[model samples]
Target: MKTQNQFQLFKERRFLPYFFVQFFGALNDNIFKNALLTLIAFGAFNQETRELLTNLGALLFILPFFLFSALAGQLADKYKKAHIIRYIKFVEILIMGCATIAFWHHQLALLFVILFFMGSHSAFFAPVKYSILPQYLERDELVGGNGLVEMGTFVAILLGTILGILLIRIHTSTLFISIAIMLTAVLGFMTSLWIPNQKTISNPDLKINWEPFSQTWYVLKRAASQRTIFLTILGISWFWFFGSVIITQLYNYNQDILHGNEAVMILMISILSIGIGLGSLSCEKLSRHKVEIGLVPFGSIGLTLITIDLSFAHGLYPEQVINVSTFLSHWEGWHILIDLFFFGIFGGLYSVPLYVLLQSRTEEKERSQMIAANSVLNALFMVVASLFSIALLTLGLSIPQLFLVIGFCNLAVTMYLYKLLPEFLMRFIAWLLINCIYRVKITGIENIPEEGPAIITCNHVSLVDPIVVMASCHRPIRFVMDHQIFKIPLLKFVFQTAGCIPVASEKENPEIKERAFALVKEALDRGELIGLFPEGSLTSNGNIQQFRKGLERILNNNPVPVVPMAVQGLWGSFFSRRYGKAMLHWPRQFLFSKIGLQITKPIPPEEFNLEELKNITQNLRGDWE
Candidate 1:
């Protein structure tokens, strides 16, 4: 089946209703929270008490996720997600009713209680909302669906914050805020009703853990059982920590560093939010509709570099309040904005993939539990970040230095993760090379086995052929490469990390050829897939070269199902020798070129032959250039 862009999912019944449900939920959340902040800031409380109350307000809202997420996760896994969502919305309406009453009477006590309940409501809803995506959308649509959800959420935050500010400044401020919160809750409930039912994936008889501390520990243990899941959760939490520190300091950054007022702060926020939205939406296209973890590292690099630059850029602006118009008129302001924009871009790139990875990898029964664990850890990380920032600032570190330290810390963390998980970096290089030069469309990817050993045989089209094929494959591939080309400078590192087996013509290097064959045999024996370019080298012309006999030798030893794959639209590219010596020619016509990889049904071991594989690959790659 052909893959569809993420936006197309919106037209389907499965995604649209849920999108609105989430959108409205986030809108109501930010509306109430921001409104509370405004009131506490401007209300009769003294300045010292106001700071305490505002911090308390933030804590109350986040505390529920810490206290109740374990229970929420259990309910989400044990019952229909749609049902849980509807019931949660019903609870939200009640919470908003309390909020309305508190606002009407201007009772600080009841308002704090309402805030705590709102936080609780969000905590319960968290696992259900995230875990429900994998249930409703196809695997290919995960990134896109997540992108839209994130974008919608941020947009809601932006709009809701603005609305709350406007409401509190009005003549009948209390009345307007009360009515807005209630009406939004009702609308959210209405949308939740339209969300399609998603049946529970966990056991109905599973015991519900009511003890938050022990249950939370149990939940975390379950997540840790899956190493990648646990690491990614940590990764996600780290992003939150990094982001919270940055955002919290932005208020100070606006006043002390940028020498700007609230208007300049808004400008910074707008640029960052817009950048994230764009970055998130672009993931589907950048990843070619797959959950490419490579983007995670790619994003981390951007995050580090841009953050470092931001530290330098902030120093260029003088410490005096600059109007928004004047801030834009200066190059220093533009530099700061650029840094913030790319920071959001990399942040989006960092987050979207990991979230999709969690959804795609977690067992359906434990998915909600896993998400709840993530929520709890994320909250913990943010809280820790606040304390860390305060300590750093107290130690005489300027805001810019704090950013610099975070950036340096980010580099250290990412490098450690990459060393632990080389797959991340390998995939990053593959994704980077492919996306930087070519737009690839892959079809029949499902024809490859989801698990277990299989042989993938494709026609060689360019020096970068293996990288392209690697990027397209969902599972890691052990490619067999010519020893000479395998030793090429920078490409050697990527090839070595990817586990490419180096071979030479038996006449020239008999021992190396034997070792290559032996390695392929062992990989297949271990239930791992090996990708081979049957034509054995880059195509000198724009046509498929004849297959070599290496496949026959490998299959003779270990008979395995062989998938015939093909690459088209790369013959004349700079990497291919179609124009002249590959890599020597400047990329005049190859920049931003589109390419395609097509896979046909697997040929049984009993039916496979060298000549037959060649014909099949050629036909699959038909008539491109």
Candidate 2:
């Protein structure tokens, strides 16, 4: 199978139409929102009142998500998502039309009401928008699809904000701004009409729970039942909170800190949005077209470091910069912009994997509800971010200092999460090991079952074979390794996090050997994959060794399918025994040596010949080692 580039998704109907619908919808939203803010800023009002109304506008917009996301999730679960998208888009057109009248009449109350309704439109659309992708696209396509969606959204928001702010500055700004938002809404509805209907509702029997509070709690509880899913939700919410703080402060940061005008604000927004878009799109390639959570930790680290850099990027410049030119002229201003851009890039890396993981792992029936729950948490976090910023700024923290706090807070939260759930960190280590040490080429990867219990039998060629295989497979596997390998100082933490099974010979440690077998049975019973290297020890001369009877014992008890895998090209590498002892090496091949993993079709339980299994592995690894 070929890996599809994320951009290729735009050529298809299932993705392209919805992508436009989202793009136009988000564009309209920001156009109206920014237009309102621009009015408040330049209107005849004091700074305090302007700030109050601006914050109020934000609150009103977010209120509907908290109030209506549960109902939206239920609607998505019980009804076809395409129909729901159409309804939401239709509502958006009406809301934007009414918003146009409000803009013309300068009716603050009506516009605020429309803003709440617009938020409701987005809230209702959120669950359906995401949950429908897996229904239409293949499992491998999900990462690319999500990346495109996220990248499109940020770009639309950037363009919308720039247009909103620029147009609202004109003398007859009302007509132009009104036309833009109204047209975008109409276009969004038209595009939504082209979205194909889902085959059926995910949970047709799932009753609609109208009460937001109780329904919200109910959905959240169901979603939280799975620890990893719940933590993934938290990770996504944290990203929103961090983003909210950064984007919210950009206005003031441009004016007060950077001493620049609205145009400079546009530049900052542009750079940040572009960075996120690139980062989001990069996820598909970086993850090798799979749902790799390692990118999450990598992304979080990038976000924290970049934001810290932004906090310290402040300067004691005395000039009153007027536009983008003056702003870009100073190295300090460029420093800030560069930070914002990279902040976006890492933010993209951080968020896209999480959304993919959430969508792919959740059950089809409860997927929308879980997404709704995520939406609820996201809104709550964003609200708290606004309040958090307000509180900090009021407590005499400069905006740059606020960014500093946001960075450290992100670091603290991610570290806590990694402790609670180490999969993110574990995957990060494996990804790093694979990328740095070897270029792994996997063949017949499709032969690996997508689910259920299975036994993986591979020839152990190196000390890091488990990590290499773990990184290649999409699902997590509880690898069975020699107890001695577990004692390695640098890798012990990762091994523990991954729940690796350590086995010793019965003579060396009977208790550990017995416990290893028990754990193997337990893991298989729970429908988990268990990895075993049946040769019993690493080959010193790069040759397959005699098969161990342990494989026979495990299969007898469990009767699970046995998959044969061959790991090649590590014979003389640093992790192989060709250099004295493994890891005590001088020189070998160049870094990133080609490592081939050939996994054959699984053998049925009745055909339980250990010699045949070894022969198949040898064939797959022929002439390589």
Per-candidate TM-scores read 0.87, 0.97
Off by over 4 Å in 1: 1-3, 40-59, 105-113, 255-265, 312-335, 439-453, 482-489, 502-528, 535-560, 568-598, 621-625
Give me the overall lDDT of model 1. 0.84
Which model scores highest in lDDT?
2
Q: Which ten residues in a row have the lowest lDDT in candidate 2?
A: 1-10
Q: Tell me the tens digit of each residue's lDDT in model 2 across 96-151.
A: 88988988898978988988998998999899888998998888888999999999
Best by TM-score: 2
For residues 1-625, could you state the per-residue lDDT of candidate 1 as single tens digits?
2238888877877888899989889989988876777676556776445545655676677778888889999998888889999999999999998888888888888888988999899999999989999889888889999999988887777767667756876779888898889888999999888987764456476788888999999999989888889999988988988887786566556756677755676678778878888889999988877889999998999999999899888646665668889898888889999998999889889999999998998988888999999999987887777677767776788889999999998899889988876778989989877777788888898898877889998888788888999888877899998998899896887898889999999798999999999999999999999999887888787788778888998889998899999888888777778778888988756566888899989988999878888888878998985
Task: Give the distance in Å from residue 94's predicted Cα in candidate 2 to where it truly belongs.
Answer: 1.2
Weakest ten-residue segment in model 1 by summed lDDT = 46-55
Residue-level lDDT for 383 in candidate 2: 84
